[model samples]
Target: MKNTILLLTLLFSVNAFADHSTSKFVWSGKCLNSNCTRSEIEAENKANYQKHLQHIQDLDAEQEEEDREWSRQHDEDQARADALPKYQYKPIPETDNCVTRFYEKASSIIGDNAKEYIDVEEIKSGKCIFGFKLMAEEMCEYFDSFSSMATPDWSEAEWCRYRSELREVYIQYSGLVGTSAFTDAVQAERKAKLKPVEDKHHKIYQNLYEQHLKQLKQ
Candidate 1:
């Protein structure tokens, strides 16, 4: 009986030790598995965040470029509006006949039978078509006459006369561009705005002409 009791005690001790070792092993494995899963979740989260940041940066850059372009266009538009003189002029010219005559001249330049999209009768009679072409020609001819009277070495008196003629032409032209009758105040404003610009252009042209003349003589 004493031997049997000893054997039973030994057996119980071995079984308890085996059970403890197995439970420890399983707990270690569970801990390692949980750590691995957490690490994978963290890596995925980091990659997604990085991608979201990159996408936001790209969007910001695009918006910045769009803003810059809009600013540039707005500035250019504002400058143009500010530079243009504010003046009133009539919508149409004093005479439609002048428009007709100008068109005839332009037609002659291209050919007697000018290939126009619209017929002359349609224009001259103020028919249901776009505006007449004669107004453009008349303006051109008027400018031509004004240019002929002015010269590179013109005296102040000649300059004054030329300036006056150009002013009148500008007034009429402005009426065509804007919907208002040409008023004295508007004519004065146009003259002020155009005289310097026109003078500069004419000076450049005269200089080129003189250079050409000298080269020809040489």
Candidate 2:
């Protein structure tokens, strides 16, 4: 009887040890085996939390760098804008005596029928003819001066106005010569005679105009 009781007690002790060794417990609402400890689960949760925090920090740092870069670019653009030239209207001076005389004579001839009816020889020998020649020479000198400038002082509007003035001078000269009433063939001949001078001035004007546009972009 004593041997049997000892045997029964040993079996009960072994069963309790087996049950304890193989037992599962709840962690984070899920059952985990004995190997998966509460401390290990807590450590894993802490690691994940740290990883999340690091990710947020990295994103913040990237955003801050982008913002800084954007601000730097904006400042640079503003600086460029500030450094660019400001536009002011400057009128071309009408200081040439020859050009002034030509304008006066041409205006008078246009208004006076008797002056218009005068012989072509008389017209050719008049002050208007001499003034036109002087005006043409002055225009050529102006073109040379404009071409020699590294940066023209005139604004685009002033440049364009000067071009218009030159056109008006030619128109007035044509009227003075009575070419406006000439046959198409005679007009063509007159244009052909003036072509070389016109082309030379036109080339200079085009180069300066291109430079003006380039500076504006800058």
Candidate 2 residue pairs in clash (backbone atoms < 3 Å): none
Question: Residue 57's C-alpha lDDT in candidate 1?
Answer: 67
TM-score of 2: 0.29
Score candidate 1 by TM-score against the native: 0.26
What's the number of clashes in each of the models?
6, 0
Residue 67 displacement (Å), model 1: 1.3
Listing every candidate in turn, what is its Cα RMSD in Å to the true structure after a full C-alpha superposition?
27.7, 23.0
**Candidate 1: 10-residue stretch with minimal lDDT:** 21-30
Q: What is the TM-score of each candidate against the true structure?
A: 0.26, 0.29
lDDT of 2: 0.48
Off by over 4 Å in 1: 1-36, 90-218
